[model samples]
Each structure stands twice: as C-alpha cells, then as structure tokens.
Target: MDDILKLVEEYIKEKDSKKTWVAGEDWVQYAGPYFTHEEYVRAVKTLLNGWLVLGAEANKFETKFPPLLGKELGLFVNSGSSANLLMLLALTSKRGRNLPKGTKVITPVAGFPTTINPIFQIGFEPVFVDIELDTLNLDLDAVEKACQEHPDAKVITFAHVLGNPPNMDRLMEIVKKYDLILLEDCCDALGSTYDGKKLGSFGEMASCSFYPAHHITTGEGGFVAVKDEQTERIVRSFREWGRGCYCIGKQNLLEKGSCGTRFNCWIPSLPDHVFDHKYVYEEIGYNMKPIELQASLGLVQMEKLEEIGLKRRENYRSLFKAFSKYPEFFHLHTAQPKSDPDWFAFPVTIKDGAPFKRSDICQFFESKMIQTRPYFAGNIMLQPAYEGLHDKDEVISKFPIAHKVTTDTFFLGTSPVINKEKTDYIEYILDCFVAAIRI
Candidate 1:
C-alpha cells in the first residue's frame, strides 16, 4: 500500500509539472481547468475505492461548497447545463408553487443556450430582454418593462454574464415588486459578488459549473445551490431520479434513513401496502447525478479558488488597461457599480466603426495560437437550434444590442493560466492587429 501511494504521488507531480503555458507552441488557451496534484490524487483515490456513484466525496463537496457562496445547501449534478435544467425544473416543482405551465420567465437572449433552454424545456415561455453593451448583462429597464407589459411573468432567470453581475440592488427591488422568483446562473460568476455579497446567494437558487473553462474544475460537474432545505430537496428530487428519499452520501442498509421513514412510510398514491421511501418516485426526474470521482476532485478545486480567482481578476484588469486607450475601436467590459467581480474572461467588443472587423481581430489571435471565443452563443435566439421555435413576438430582437453582440463581441482568457507573460503577449498582438488595420 505504501509503494502504491508513492507511485500515485509521483504520477501527480510529473503530470502537474507539464501543465504550464509554453508561449509560442501552446495556445493561450481560452480557458483551462485550474487543478493540481491534490485534485488528481483525490480523484484517483475515489476511483480506486470503487464507489463510482454518489458517495462520501459527493456528500462532502455538496455540503462544503454552498457556504463559500452563502448558500445553505447544494445538489451536485452531471454538468452545469444539467444543473440549469434541474434548477428550473425544481422551481416548477411543489417548492416553487408549482408554477403553472406556460408561465412567462423573463431572461436575456444573449446568454448560454441552457440558461434559456431549460425555461422552454419546462414549458415556460421566455420574454426576451436585451443586454447592456457595457456590462453584457440584462438591461434592467427592459426587464422592468417586460414585467409590467406581461403581468403574468412569474420567474426571472439569467446568468451573471462572463462574471459581470447585473445591478442586483435594482434587480432585487424589481423581484420584490413583482413577487417574482429568481434563479441565477452563476456558471461564470463563482467567487464574484455584488455589494460584497456572493452572486449565487442573492437568488432563490443558483447553478454553477465546474467545467474546464469555469472558475473551478471538477472535470464535468456542476451544482445547484439553494437558499433552504425545501428547495434543496426539490433540486435533489430532480437530480436523484425523482426519488423522495433524502439519504445522502454512502448509505448503510442497516442504518435508518435520514428522515427515519425509510421503510415505515405509507404512500397514499401507492397500493395499500407499505413501501420503502427510497423506491418511491415523487416527481418525474432524470439521472443527472455526478460520479464520486468528480466530486472528490471538486473538494480540492474549491480550496484553490481564492488563489486562482486572484489571478483571473489580475488578468482581466491588465487586459482592460491595455485596451482602455483604444475605446473607439473596442468597447471593453464594465462591471455593475456595486459588483466586485471575479471575472470569467476579459470580454471585448469591436466598435461599429472600428477599422477592422471582429473576425479580423479574432483571426489574428487564432493565427498567433492565442485562443479567442465568441461570447457564448451571442444572441442565442438566432442560433440554428432555436430558429423556428421562437415567435416574432416571443423574442425581442428589435433591441439591437444582442444582435450587435452576435457580430462584434468576443472574449479572451482570464483564467489562472493567463499570467502576466500571456497577457502581455495578448496586448502586444492586439496592438499589432490595430496598427496593421490603421494602415
């Protein structure tokens, strides 16, 4: 056992050492997983234990993660996309007043597909809102207008775009005025806060991603953080195949269930015989639970968040400073007045009258092997998948900002992997591109 442990330690060191960004050869990766030996070891240890499904690691991660973002509880899922779906589905469950079918949900059109997809998937209509070019978040006035125009709007779901938080002060006021439910997609906003409070904590429930590009990595894992136990149960119900049993972690058959009703319950809907609560299906659910290995890695990833988050912030600032002088050509990102963001990336948009086009600059970055990505499905409503589904009135593409994003916006990496050296290189290349275009 001692020799085996030594081998694992050695394997981690050798692999971790090779992960550095090697300037010219390696692409200044748009984003990559920030992980180390600790995460690797934990993942390996969990896999070796052979408890492949949800178990101790998942339990610890779920419990430990929520507090960092001020959430009281969390539910782990296979991916952030799945987390979004489950979060919305949970709201439409009993805990969320079982929002009636065809209820209107106000959300931005300029966001990841899953953030808006789940609304439609759960049979709710999304009243599209335009995003602000500066913050790349929902336009608050448009949101209020949508709410007043459509008095039936019961839910507001949106992401903290590229880690830039919206005006939460006014957002919450609107929420209160309308008695609307809030679901934050914090996939890009982990470690970010508005008015000193964490982004995820402000909403009824928030979803986070641990995909390679996010603030942290658990390979392909995500979690839904809830404000209370009832919401947590609703999220878990959807994640754990609609089962009503609440026993988390590794369960021992000999031990009584967490609720102490494992075998003692009588289901009114079931035939007159007593049934184990574990086998009972409460809501139609899917198998969205993540494996224990990912959860084990997530525990280690959570610890490195602070250090990694600092680098991301630094990278964003450096990029912003570099581009500030070129505002006419580029409209760089801005955070809400009260937001102190732990940014996901350094987003930049080519101004309408820029000498060159968005493609021109992005191609230049690609040629240099420094990766750039278009803002996640800019104007997602225009994407092929959403083509015929949205009616002319259902989506508000009339506001040109979202459509402009589709043509003008793109982002560069601000992940921990982007250090001073890479950021300098990015600036140097941007300078060259602009210089070339000027001639």
Candidate 2:
C-alpha cells in the first residue's frame, strides 16, 4: 500500500506540473479548483480505509475549516444550498433561537436562487431589495429603507457578492438598529474579511460552498458555520436527517457510545414517552450530509487557503486595472471599505450608454478562448420558476439595478489561474474591443 501510494503521489505531481495556458487555445475558466498531491494522497488513503461515510474525515474538516471564519463549530452538508437551508431551518429549532414561522428574511434581488429558495422552502417571508451597482452587494441604504418600511422584518439574508461584502460597519449598524438576524451567504467570500474579521463571523449563521468553482473543492459540499456549540448541534440535526443525536464521526459507531450509555434515551417499561436519541426526529429535514471522501478532499484544500486568497486578490487587482482602462465603457466592482476580498470573480457592468453592448465584448472574450459568466441569476423574479412567487406586480420594476445587472453585468476569471500571462491576454482582448468600438 505504501509503495502504491508513493507512486500515486509522484504521478499527481508530474501530471499537475504539465498544465499550462495558451493565448487562444485554452479556455480560461472564471473559477476552478486548485488541488495538490496532498489532496490526491489523502483521498486515496481514505478510500483505502473503506469507512466511506461521513466519519473521521468529516469530523476533522468541521474542526479545521470554521476557525478561519472565526467560528468554533460547523455542520457539513451536501452543498452550499443545503448549508443555507440547514442554518435557516436550525433558527426555528427549540434548542436554537426558536424564531417563529413566517419570519421575514430580507434579501437582495440579484443573487443565486438557492439563497432565496430556502426561505420559501422553510416558510419564511422574503422581502427582495436592490443591490449597489458598484459592489453588486445588497444596498444597505436600501436595507435601512426596507427596515423602516417593513419594521416587522426579523432576518436579513444575502450573499457576499463575488466574495466582496458590502460595507460591514454600516451593515452591522443596520442589523443592530433593526434587531435583525444576519444569515449571511459566504459561499463566494470564503477567505474574505471585513474590518479584520472573516466575512462569516459577523452573521448569526453563515453558509459556505466547496464546489470546484469555489475557493475550495470537495466535488459537492458546503458547511453551516456558527459561533456557538448549541447552534452547531441545531444545524447538525438538520444536516443529519434531523436526528436528535449529536454524536459525530466514530462516536455514532462506538459500541457503548461516547457517553458510555448506549441507547439510553428511552426505557421501554416506562410510559414516559422516551426514545433513542438517534431515532428521535427533531426538525423536518432532508438528507444533506456529504461523504467522508468529500471531507478528505476539503481537508487538503484548506492547507492552501491563505495562498489561494493571496493569488485571487492579486488576480482581481490586475483584472480591475485592465478594465479600469476603459472606464467609459465599464463599471468595475468597488469593494467595501476596510474589507479584504479574495474575489471569486471580478464582475463588471457595461455602462448604460457604452458604445458597445455586453454581447459585443462577450463575443470578443469567447473568440479569445476566455470564459465569462453572467452575474448569477440576476433579477431572479424574472426567472420562469418564480413567475408566481411574488404577488406584487410592481416588484419587477422596484429594483432597477438588479434588472440592469441581468442585462449588463458579467464576470471574468479571477481565480489563481489568472496569472500575469492571463492578465496580459485579457488586456489585449479589451484593447481590441475598444479599437473595434472606436472604428
């Protein structure tokens, strides 16, 4: 086994080193995973161990990943979407905050569907609001306005746009003033920080992704982060089939149990309505746990978190500089003050009256073998699935910035893959577009 593992490690190094970029031949993806030989080795070792469920590897990951976000505990789930649902659902748990049904969750109009979908799924009332054009984050001014208009709103949920959070100082002030719960979606802002604290730390509950396109990759995984153990257990209950049992990893499989009182939640003779902890249903939840294999892969990915964040920021600056050269044609992303963003992708909005259309520049990028993505699910109200979701006919017109984003905003690769070579290539592409528009 040792000899075979050594061979595997050497092969991974050889294969990984061979990857390279070509000016017009390789498609530079907007985001992707960066894995090393350590990841490969750990994955293989875990596979060999044959304990394939969420056990030791998952346990290690929960402990290791959250501290960077200033959290002491977390619950691993199948995806970032599930992480959102887990945390939001956990808020209703008797053991947790125990907020009432129909709690109002204020969110940005422009964001991925999963963030909003969970609100409806959990029967929470969603109040959609606009985002800042420059930051593509929820407009806190609009949020304060929403709070004034809908004073009953109890929670605020929104993504840190492309890993750049809105002004945290102002956001916290709004949270405090309105007495609202912050359910932040840190899916894009894994290593980002506001006021020297991680993006996920300020919120009551936060969700993070581990998709290949995210800062880390576990094939398909995410986690719900929390500041306290009780919230952790509440979220854990939702993730683990809503069981009351809090046992993690090998503890579940222990012969007498970690508590040394196996199956003691119930006594059959006593009519006291007792039941085994594992069989006790707590919350109405779906199965959303990720496997041990995914956790093993994530463990290795966290080792490169700091370095990955540095490269992403460097790439974002280069991209921002390149686009800033065409200020008349673009509205480049402006990050929040006192915040450090390890940008997921550098988003840009085509100026409303720019000479060239978004399609024009998108075509140029495609020709150069550069990949681009539309800002995620902009104006989700316009989507077919949510046709009847909103009752107000004026809802679509209320958030003009989100509508503009749907038509005008796009993003380019800011992953570590966008090195000096990619930056130069992108500048050349932009220059060609500018020249064409001038002609």
What digit string (tens of lDDT, one per residue) describes model 2 on residues 378-405? 9888888888767545666788899889
Local lDDT at 27 for model 2:
83
lDDT of 1: 0.87
Q: Model-by-model lDDT, in order?
A: 0.87, 0.86
Which runs in model 1 stand beyond 4 Å of their true positions? 18-22, 391-397
Q: Where does candidate 2 have its weakest 10-residue lDDT segment? A: 262-271
Cα lDDT tens digits, model 1, 27-123, are 8988988766677677777787889988888889988999766697998899999999988898778655788779899998887899989988889
TM-score, every prediction: 0.96, 0.96
